[model samples]
Target: MTTETAGGPTGPAARPAPHRVVIVGGGVTGLVAARQILRDRPETTVTVLEASERLGGQVLAIDVDGVAVDVGAEAIHLGAPAAADLARALGLDATVIAARRGQSVLLTRRGLRPLPAGVGPTGPTRVGPVLRSGILSWHAIVRAGLEPLTRRRQAADVAVGDFVQGRFGREVTDTFVDPLLGNLHSGDIHRLSLQATAKQLVPVAESGTSLLLRALRKPTPPPRRPDEPAPLPMFASWPGGLGALVDALASSLEGHATVRTAVRVEAIGRTGDTWRVDTGEGPVEADAVVVAVGPRPAAVLLGPHSPATARALEAVDTASVATVVLAYEREAAEQNPVLRDANGLLLNSSQSGVLKAMTNMSRKWPLGHPSWHIVRVSVGRAGSRVAVDLSDAQMIAAASGELATLIGLNATPVFATVVRWPDAMPQLTVGHPGRMAAARAELAGIPGLHLAGSAADGLGLTSTIASGVQVARTLVG
Candidate 1:
């Protein structure tokens, strides 16, 4: 609408309305973004609209027999300090607890064995670990060791499988990289991007000579002295599961921002330099808007006005996944050595049939449960249809059957609960980094429009939180 002057209606005048931001999703990312925006621009108005009745998105928890069980992400990766910093700042540090043990075994043809010391999410880093574990045959080991002789890959972007297999052999890719990187993204390594997903290997990938040679030349740190403070744990979580984090983040925004649940944003369009956010209830006019939902939802909202932006978002791939939390009889669990200490098992490519990985929550957080031996089982992966048709009962049965075969736990679980997330796990395919960059570059042309979520740049709590902080700073600064 044009502003009316003394003589006649003037062309679209300056924005006289108070500066307000309409956040399109109420998940952790959106809420965190809202929190940061309010902190930076104290005078600006912020509105958080969530489609679901509950917040937290994938970071959720459910009650089973009166005990809160995390059906989604349970651990907070401490490699980055975004989550830890946010938790501490929100007074959630006291509730945080470190893993009692982190020793995880790999499912091999020989049986479950300790993972190679130097093996990571990308691929093998040291030969000694693979040699000791005997997970690789001598032929594959020699092939992997000779990777220094292979020519550097010429592609600007390559598949993670190709990069790892080129540096290591195919066997190593299947045995080592599959479970860590593949299962992590719920995607196939052959399709997942090396540059986008595996950042640690880029230096070695670009080196053109040898991953092992470079790994061997790395310096080792000296032992810590008694007076030195302890480094942060690799992973941590509150006793209340990740839901505590969601609760804390939501509470931090109380009175600082307007948070509304069950409010779905239908479309976003520009009206004379102002954003008109059409929602289920009514329209919300704001100075800026942040689309923090998954790419699918974001695509639906952005398609009407910004087709290019919407298509860029819609092109992103996602996989459906389900989590099954099973409680077993204490006596049966105590007898099983696998449940005694350490984390659960990571299924290699051969064993990636019905289960992805299982977490032994009883010992991972031993203090939380003394009576029940609880296990959290992850199912589904990109391009896999095994879990698509399974119901809650079927999922539980499959999870139990696998646990029995893997750990010799024949006893039935005392309780079980299933949580399914459809098209939730985002896949970073080859050229994904470039696609994201192009999408962002295109988004920059459109003022007051921003994208921030796991779907935006990365997955997991740390990356999502970092994206939120970045989008907020960019919007408010």
Candidate 2:
């Protein structure tokens, strides 16, 4: 239908109002989504609903005797594009701090041994360094040397521990990988999924390629500009700690978003073309909704409408772990030879128990005062409930005693604190990602409903934040 001149069309139709997107949960995933939605869909009205009073979730910080330290997540790979881009946009480029140079030692049957170069959580990238380090026996080293001839067992998915064991042997997996990766995920190595945990390795596992060779062909970072401060390390954290990242995200969301805290979302359902997010007070409606909470809470919300999704979420299990921080006099701690150049120390499960690893926080990061040396002692893992029942005082004492025994830290700590995370880490077991994908694909049939977070994408800051960013783009389209 052709219309006339300056008056425009004969009959004008009013355009619809801007879209409304409701984000559930207030953790890193939810917060990232909220900021992203506001950025991508500038006209869209955004509201973030948080179940708890805290908005950052695991990105938390606390002051221990005048020193600010992360009680939750501590650092991130600032060199990675996603983190770098986000930090640049947030005006945090100048404030990033690198992990100070040091070495990590492994507590093996032969006692404390320096971790060989080119070694990772799974296995050594080069056999030469490991052969000399003696973390494994002569016989085990010989077995690993035969990795090029190892039989290929291709599958769609496999356990990380099994993959390492097939290429190396049980001794390598138990002595090295189990202590490193196990503590990282707070789950068992044999149960963690290779596909979900490390997607890049899935292709290598399926191709039966030599992981050692592939690991060697690592990607190189772009050359740094001369004006840039120093080459940004692989990881960096703010002087305020990791919590600063969360605070910056929240700050950016101001004026563009309506963030509500301590407001519990009881359930979510579709009514007509909009979604109804029911809170204790009333219902908040929106055109689209993102469920970025953990698995258990997510299950509770999706149970009524999408039973399959609820079941899939319910099936995903989690393990509990704790972080205990202890501070000591700089002179006292540095007296021990290990504390001078130690970034951290890892102990096998079979070794003198309770504590599995310890991070020399003062040496690792320069945020604290030089007069005091701080250390973070990590305890608990999958299938072990030792940390679950221990009282805070008991945990502090036990960790302090372990430090004294391990490094000759005979002097009493100046200050100490313990923080417990109960069932906080999600277990991405074998076949879990496929199960989640199928559920999400099925959920696609329902309009205006989506999932994004550690529960859906697995743990780690990179994966969780990436999931939220993807969800934002989906909503915009």
Candidate 3:
């Protein structure tokens, strides 16, 4: 029953062996955790087991028209420091570049209309833009203008949809909030937790101040000093796409940790004070274990060890989304200035179609193929079943038809690729905080066990990385 320590062995004549840690899942969260642990405790043995043959879970890249394009996540919100800090630590700071263009329009029944200028991603900040954009009716505009003067009552938590609807009216919620937040989180705004999604605006809501007044009072930034460098872009990504980040993380773990692909972890249990992980290949014994898989898989693995934690995790729901990338002739896009000018387009929920959003990839980032134009179409949302049930061909057709209707481009694409992510995004409902707190409490009672990922925390890239680093630091300490 005796195990050798890190030094060498447990026998009187041998040195103690190092602590053993096993991480299930090779996605960004698990990879980051392995890297952090190895960096902090070099002598500790770390093993990362991924079911898939590749490392990154949702972050991936593919070739279209002889150019590498991001098929999964493509941007990181610079509002948070976690992603940027990790990039700097990994020596990827120089590779980071902001979006070449920031303008996005909404595809409505009337046609494409610019989203109100100066409007926050989730809602409108200024009334002038909303009025001038012509996206709202005159009545809706008047109601929205009165939002600042409206009285505000604060609650501990509220749904993003309900909060915006009550304060700003239904027009703003449906036209602005739904499409923007839906495209970002891949979930329904009515179910998305306000605190988890838009923590910045909560204070304004609670203060009962006029949103317009507050936004107008927002002071302009002081001029930068001559010696100061330019501020980082609001969003940034790697030149090779987000997949490069995954490759970088894996490369950094070389010589320090063991990484195994195509290894599925069936179950995890504790034996004495040590932990045992059952994989398809064999069983792994470790001093500690980190479960970085999705909530459903994590629930199954923890069910036998901790039913309460399992129940909490199983209660969490997820959404599925599919990305369809189409590469068209550059002439087709050039012929239509709208396609060339738009960085991205968000679909109004009221619009009749399967396509939820479209990103003009070529315009957003240089793909090194000037002769080709790449457009990425996102399908499905929190409550929609269109993407999960449809075949890849059908999805592509739907996307193509929608694109043609939105922009006048009917020529066949030179290349097309579909990436389906089933149950990849976690739905953070209003009561999510309580469930997460309970899960954490249950995990604290179990020794040598940790959980981290988009399911455990919020769905942003920053939150996911921060969760991994936080858990690894706790285990290392």
Candidate 4:
């Protein structure tokens, strides 16, 4: 909402206002940092420069045929302190509801089958349902039972795929975890750090107990505040969609924030005490600069300033991902078995020929409602042999075909939307934390320079928000 020259709020022709702090990247991280900086230090001038004209990076939402289609992140996994704090700060009206975890279908060679209870993303949390389910062979179940007897390999961290395949057998990893947790990371399980990705179940794997017993006896710490309610499915987007959160944060800055679109940051270099940021238009000098882009971009920008940081960032590989949004008539799709669907079913990459997973947006969130009868299908992995290669229309056709087989549907969708994110989700390899620590230490010497993004921490809205808030605290402190 504010416009100013490189001279900033104060120039020789005008009275000086405050210290100028430039925030690069206008995604959630940059916007959050701008808000935090303005709130913490009113004397400081905050500006957000985004390469894209639109903000909210991955938390993007669009209206298609009078229906709200979330092209990016649909769910908010923020629990407790983060969610409550953010909701209050933004004055966002959020509805508390649990994610549709039950009434899911598991696609198999036979047909769409009811998802067996106790078979979580990690493994069977309870043994009864798993034993009864015909999904796994008897031999595979016996192999799973031997997990407690298996020795915990002494390593800093291992790939989730390796660990699961070694302990539970390849069938479990491919059949269940691959489609469930694997899809969560866009199906780059081999590269995904077990420490960062499947940390909740790490202790169970480490303990000399079967996953079922471990899950049952897992010592979950009681809430510090008993009166506070458990977060409802982490948190969902407000009525207007996730974009509402971004718009609210941007508006809160008022005239303080300056968002530059269609301007690519060519390079970032250190100039004595201050850092110089090079853009397509020109260079902007600032006392502080936050590189909040993806890891690959961060590596490119920080190469001159901090080679170690750059290399460290480069160590974290990124995977390309695609999200396909398809719409169908509700009554027409009712005949499909999977379509009796409570929400949507998550498909394992190995089982489903085309899709990694799918979400029934209309059933899950209020934005789409039932009229749209929307479904979101994910495709691709961080790195894998087999891959899905199809244009928007082709991808939709493939997904529709799968739907037809799974649910017995023959009707065509009105229209479909596809969002491709190239090198978006970062693959946090083993020893990721250590590598990040070393990079941070190297960059610590440089004053007025900070790092914040999905690449900095674990990929998620909650983590990205925390990175921005933490960087702001570091600066103010």
Candidate 5:
């Protein structure tokens, strides 16, 4: 174990020690950085300083009453190399569970209605099912069919909403794309960056190809082994929750991470070759420092060393959100396969109130003991009133009300927890990708410092892990 000196950094009266690393954050990025450093240079003393009393930062797990609630990053969007490799190396079992499937009940003007077959977040894949379904008017469907005839453009950047609207019309954007993709980003499609959001679809658009044809032509992989469960549509959890993953990474670092709970960083400055991280506790020295906090905090910490980076980061924007987990007996949730078997439902952004999405935990994982059904509800958006102004009680109430209305039940939740993330999910607005590339180039000259976390790339657990791994590789070398 890394021996952490809670006594603070070097003192003026004492002889300063050799070059040691002090990771500023204890989230997945910092933990992964510390782990990677140790693997490469086992002799270097490292310390991770965290302002929070607990680890995991946004990725947290809380026992609400008797059920565990994932306060942030409910699941991995895409299980890429970084997340998968780390889980295996840490001795954590990677079990796959199928994502939510089956009839999705939609709350519309006509009340709760089920989405017909062939239609998903992307779009309707089967013409027969879509034609037979009443989700869209014939006129709207005809407009959508004109996607193949839509004009293509080679612009550097365009709004996701504009692109989709230009091709499929407003009905598709508001009804299908907005609710599905918008809910995922906690953003509006009109303002989001196509390069950042629909990265894979860019080539198809450039080729003047058909979205339906591309969907149809996409290869489908074979089934998984009988012994190996199929991977979840998105990766998630730390086996014991995100906290466990943080703990595991922290354990490998020994004394490297200096967790300073409640000590807010005041500012950061450069002195000769060293970077001084000023905090309420004191100034900690580093060869170079990575401000892993969100844009606002990063701005506070960066000071004037890199004004452009700070400004860009500050302008990067973020959405505020809260996750509420409600538990119920198995019998109480009968008929809702999502609550009984699948991963849970991702609501369309068109839904009113503070709630946006929900996940069924017990249904998605292999539970050891039979227990009550666990469901997680995410609330608020980037600039929504629910994000900043609403109190925890208000947020919970709003979420619970929506739950009651949607599920046809209004009983008081046995366990409810609210998590307020001020700058939770970063909004990759139009030109965000270009801006990120520029920021990366500017920071490239700075040594022993690396920027990481969800804001730097995509969102979710897998991205976070990947960010950490990338930072690790940079710092280790």
Candidate 6:
């Protein structure tokens, strides 16, 4: 093999050879990284190795009643620019649509109550909404109101549950924070890292000001000018489904990179300046390598080369989840007109149910089927065996029963499918930032080696795609 310098050849007699890069794990992160590398350096040759037979790791779409529905990741945060920018770059701007602005209820013991306006994944952003929502008792409300007067400790890291409970009281933490933030990781809020999961709340928490007060003090953005275009929705996705994104990314990389599925990378070794990757089939060499696989698998591959990096990677944990899709005819949905008004519902941890959340797909997006209604029920969470131990039939039955009870639906769905994602979401528990920092620092010493994925950053379309792009730019430089 020949090596080329960054500046290319000094004379015409010697033309610089193309840089060869091999990416492990053909998930969205790996694919995005490959695309960035190819775009930035057209002379670079890229290869993507995936252990599974297909691509798009968690971003998957399945056919339900002749319409494409997303079983895995369904929406992208419009608050973040990475995903939107990438979508536009891929010529998917026209296909992008925002989530319908509809009321989403919370299943409390008292019955279904609207999720207090201004309450978010972290906690209650505005006090007026929480005060009027009646989700908390009068005494709990008083305690939450006194948050601004309370003293807060300045800690580098803390648990989300601990921080929120300390500031807003247990009632708020249990009713609002737990279901919203905890469900995001499919894990307990008490174990999730405050900095890693809810970084937006860090400044508010450490400022010693009441979180609710600060939220109220926040100024609203100015109204759009008459000449300005309409704003995008808070969440956006392709009409076909999120899978369209995966398909587009893969197609864009056709001649620029080679994507090989069903190819598992066993180990990674370094020989002098070049990196050697050993797959199930054979060994391959590359000028640079990007490891975008899950943390555990990445640890296994990097153990021999860097034990410290492996140890750090091992510290990151993951959670499994399953999404059950149910399609109902228009007649079945007509029995419950409320389904048409609301976008979805989230279950409180205190509620007795197998489902953590449910989304009314037909209302949230335009499925183009007026006679059909699609609903997605999510089951299982970190440390929960509801989905792991149950069979497909059991999962479907549980979801069906829950929907019937919640929506008063007696009719059966026209189609039902269960999609299980094992170890799909990474849990960024306390100390995760420090752990990742140490790992990245150690890996930096190894030239031409980079790590990028949800494990390195936080989980979400924005963070994952940004991680891939950042690593790709670093390699290109």
Show how many residue pairs clash in every candidate, following the order shown: 0, 0, 10, 2, 14, 1
Candidate 2 regions off by >4 Å? 1-17, 151-153, 215-231
Off by over 4 Å in 1: 1-18, 151-156, 207-209, 222-230
lDDT per residue for candidate 1 within 313-374, as digits (tens), equals 77778999988899988888878878775487888755766788988887787435657888
In model 6, what are the clashing residue pairs, if there are any?
A: 186-382
Among the numbered candidates, top lDDT falls to 6
Query: How accurate locally is residue 455 in candidate 5, as Cα lDDT from 0 to 100?
Result: 68
Evaluate all candidate structures by whole-model CA lDDT and list the values in order. 0.79, 0.79, 0.80, 0.72, 0.66, 0.81
Error of 3 at 86 (Å): 0.9
Candidate 1: C-alpha lDDT: 0.79
lDDT tens readout by residue for model 5, 1-477 = 333232212112222234466667777776776666555555556666778777678777777654455677655544566776666566454433334454545554445555556655545666666567566777788898887777575563687778878877877676667766788778877888877777766775577677755655767867778986445344455454556566666665555445555666677777777877777888888775655666667666653665556656777778877777777666666455445444555566666577786766666654322546667787878778686788778877888787777766635666666667776778878877787787777677666555777666666666667777677557655
Q: What is the alpha-carbon lDDT of model 3 when measured against the actual structure?
A: 0.80
> Model 3 — TM-score against the truth?
0.91
Clashing pairs in 4: 179-348, 336-407
Model 3: per-residue Cα lDDT over 231-334, one tens digit each: 56777787878887788888888766899999999999787999999998999999999999998999998778777777777877888889999888988776
lDDT of 6 at 298: 84
Summed over model 2, clashes come to 0
For every candidate in turn, the CA RMSD to the true structure comes to 7.0, 6.1, 5.2, 5.4, 6.0, 4.7
Model 6 misplaced stretches (Cα beyond 4 Å): 1-17, 222-231
The residue-level lDDT of candidate 3 at 62 comes to 88
